[model samples]
Target: MNFFEQQDRARRNSGRLLILMVLAVLSLITLTSLALGVVWQLFGQSHSSLWLASDGAIGLLPSWRLVGVVSLAVIAVVLLGSVYKSLQLSRGGQAVAERLGGRLINLAPQSLEEQRLLNVVEEMALASGTPVPPVYVLDDAGINAFAAGLTPQDAVIGITRGAISLLSREELQGVIAHEFSHIFHGDMRLNTRLVAVLHGILLLGLIGGFLLRGSSRASSRSSRNNSAAAIIAVGGTLWLLGYAGTFFGSLIKAAVSRQREFLADASAVQFTRNPQGIAGALQKIGGNLYGSQLRAGHAAEFSHMYFAAGISRALDGMLATHPPLDERIRRVTPEWDGRYPHVASLSLVPADASADQRAVAQGWDQALAAGFSPASATAAIASIGEPSAAHLQQAHQLLDELHPALRQAAHHGSGAQALLYGLLLAPVAGLREQQMQLLQPLLNADLMSHLQALEQPLRQLPGNQRLTLLDLAMPALKQLGTEQAATLCAVMARLIRADGKVELLEWTLLRIVERNLAPSRRLSGHFHLLELADEVQVLLSFLARAGSILPEQAQAALAQAAVELPYTGLNLLPAAQCDLKALEAALKRLNQLQPLQKPRLLKAMARCIEHDGRIEVAEAELLRAVADLLDCPLPPLLNTTSAAQVG
Candidate 1:
């Protein structure tokens, strides 16, 4: 599926969820109204002498106004609860991990298992063209993992201890691939929203518990029989209603979560080109005594987010968030004979020297292969969110090719800062000297030395490798204090300006880093394409100019793109008018377009870049950068010869 189309579908699902939530709320309102009606009838019956003289209608039918008031109160309670929980979780995936008692893995892993896990996560990030997310390990001894965040930038991957200790490296990679699929599919946002909505439904149960306790204490303290009885009745009613809410909430979670698990499982197989890897993990989960169960008290709250059902079901699997293990395995490994595989204790496996050398050689070979054609460019666009085995192989090879020191540097805060600064240093001696001069005042002497030392290696790196290193450095760079981050941004801005010209690569690198590091830079809205046509035009013009060397070529690219967009009167802006500042502004606005609109924009972009019937490395890099800026995880554009091409 096209990345934008998937995003649009996710948005639609979110809308459907909202509609379902409204229906649920209405159901709760009706239940509450009925309970209140019974309470009113009982109250009248208890005061029969006073009610006997009045109209007997009071006992038969409850007051309409009272029902109305109760409905309003229930709606208010549920909405307020959901909003409060959503705001709390706005801190992002880190918050969810911490909530479940997960410990963040150190950047420099101390254990072989931790190191292996980190490597797999890094490769997945690189292959998917997303920034490397922080990894968290739950103490729970279960074979489960999850991805959580509102967006890829803030995303985190969480794995159970059992997954690390019980599964082989390939199995672990499969699990990680599944989690990354969730991240790519935009499932985390929906999962978080589900968490918030469910919390709202569960609030009634909490309130009931509080009321019951209060009533019990009051009855013991005084002889207020009538008041005590009244409290007991109300609390008892709410307690039942709370459970009713939970029942429906669990159903909603189950409905939304199960199918996604199947998709992710298939995606994992597609990604690794090894169904047995994921199937083996599943079989092990089935055979192991623990069977993917979590000990955390909050496990049930986010059970649907897990790679498998993280808790045992007492309802005969009715409330299970994931599909049956055997069934899932059957889908991945169709030849399975319905047998569970016995998992042994995990052992550390040493890296193969020959394989490493071969991968590194292969990486360079692939880099120098023929440049992409128009068909390849279109294929690359389609490959977004659907990374194949080739992408995984490329990721592994790229990681192997990176200098060990640079890779290690990407894992730590201080080293990551130096790496970023080093990448920003210009190749020209005069500009490099000026950048160093600007940095000397802001950084300590040790940091300055590190930056200076990394320049030569950074200069020798390939374009894709450079981007991969930047992606790897994201989690570590995120550890910087606000002041330090701001300084880094300032230094980068100065370096980009020192040469008096902003190369496309330089601008893209700066944009990627800044957009990720600074949360305020994230644009949040859902406007239609027509509503943001001017912003789209500006962005398309900048993209066209970035892809072509000549003004006429740029104009031609823009013309190709304009035909795809529905808007008329769109034309290429002059090179002076389409500067980095203008492009940045345009991106900020385009980021606000609705999910469906983004696909159209991307299609147009592909058309613009492939107008010359060739996709140069610079053009491909720019396209990937633009895709990343738009929150789309585009796989690398490998050289291909095909008849079909993207519009």
Candidate 2:
């Protein structure tokens, strides 16, 4: 499936998951009512019998009032647990990785293996035009990996130490590509929801376990045998019920996760176009002693999120989050032999990163030499969330071509702040000096020094690479603490307003940065094209003006783009109506577009840009920036002219 189809499917699956969870909850309530009723009848109230159907008899079924009270209690606990997890994860993918015993890979990694891994991830992100996600290392023997987050901006890739040490660079790329597929397919958001939903279901068992332990302690602490016996009975029943509820939850996870793994494996091959790369990784997993089994305490909680099954048990056939090892290999490599590669130990011969990394610069230069044809709107939209080998190669080239200092700066918090500051420094001497004077007191000495150091390089940086630099700095920028991030946002605003006007390119960059720094939690919404009239007008009109210089030209461009909008009576709004502030506000709402609706809207925007038949590199960047804010990751396949000519 393409990006749009996969997203739409994920949206539908979320609904299905909710329905299934509700069914499971209902089953638990019934089972709990019966079990609790028996407990009440057996010990607390001996007068009642064990059946509700007995004619005019007080059976095991408790009074409706008692059952209602118990049911409400269960619901309250479940909701509380679910909400707690949801809020915790709202802190984004980093929270999940940390919870799973993952240590974030420092931007300036010391080890060769870490550097290589970072390079691969950076190339992939650059190729896909996504922010380079922070990578985390789980100090586990398992050869497993996962992509976690509610959105791309906050997404992170996590890998076990074994995978990093055991797999070859190509094989690791295959594995990373598979996880990236999960991010692209909208699976990460679903996975986050699943974690929250299942946490609620499993909380009952945690409570039951706690109660059982408490009763045991009471039996020893106090010589009250009858009270202790009653406690044991209640605790044991709840424990048993909780186990049953967990089984239901596992089945739910298996149902939602199994098929997605297959799709991701397929997508990995599509991404690298290297079947053996992924197949080798799978074979190694099948033969390894630890395989993909994790030692993390919460491994079972995130079982469905792993690149492979992290917890293997007797009921694996029914509860397995991933497919059978041999089965996955066969799908990836149809002619695979029955015997798996025996990976008792890894031949991890360390190599210097500078000497071992691919010739990405050469390859990227080759691609540029060959020339890339500009894509139509449909083709550009299709490339969203789908990065090919060419895109990967180009990403490597782009990163390789970038200045080392600028790149190093992109990888750390202070350096990233300096890089952004340098980008916003006015081109004119007077404006540049004015902005500097304004920033002098606001920024720290260290930050000012970094900005001064990067000034010359930043000014000479290609316009195309400007946005790339911003995206590359995202993970580092995200490292800032709350107040620091707020201050950073304020400084960004001051720099933009230093000249008392907002340029199109600068405004777009500011929006992209701000949105990524504080992403929207919305996955999909019910807002249709017809319902979002004002938003549609603002966004389209803004694009129309950005791509057309004159009033008449903007009108004509707006009309050309309006064909793609599913609404009637759409017209070009006056410049005041679609000012930058209005455009930003409109984008915040358009972000809620349904998965299917986004493509049409993006295509319409593309139509407006190409209405003049050729796109300036700056205009193309603006189109991409707008699309990025809408949560549609547009690829870098537009014009390559060097200057920053927006219109």
Predicted model with the maximum TM-score: 2
Superposed by TM-score, candidate 1 places the C-alpha of residue 286 at a distance from the truth, in angstroms, of: 0.5
Alpha-carbon TM-score of each model against the true structure: 0.90, 0.93
Q: Candidate 2 on 1-647: residue-level lDDT in tens?
A: 78878988999999998988888888888788777877777676743335546477644566687778788978887789899999999988999899998887757776777888888888788777788899999988768899999999999999988888778888888999999999989899999988898888788888888888998998988876877877788778778887788888888889889999999999999888799888998988888888988999988888899999999879988888888988999998989987877775544434435534544332222121222224434455777887777667667667887877788899888999999888888889989999999999999999999999998878777766877898889889988887888898889888998888989877877777787788866745668888888999998888888777798898888888788888767788988999998988898888888888988898888778777776666766787788888887776663333111211
lDDT of the candidates, in the order given: 0.80, 0.82
Off by over 4 Å in 2: 44-59, 221-224, 344-377, 638-647
Which window of ten consecutive residues has the lowest lDDT sum in model 2? 363-372
lDDT digits (tens) for residues 120-224 of candidate 1: 888888877789998999987678898998888888999988888788778888999999889888899999999999888778777878888999888888876
Best by lDDT: 2
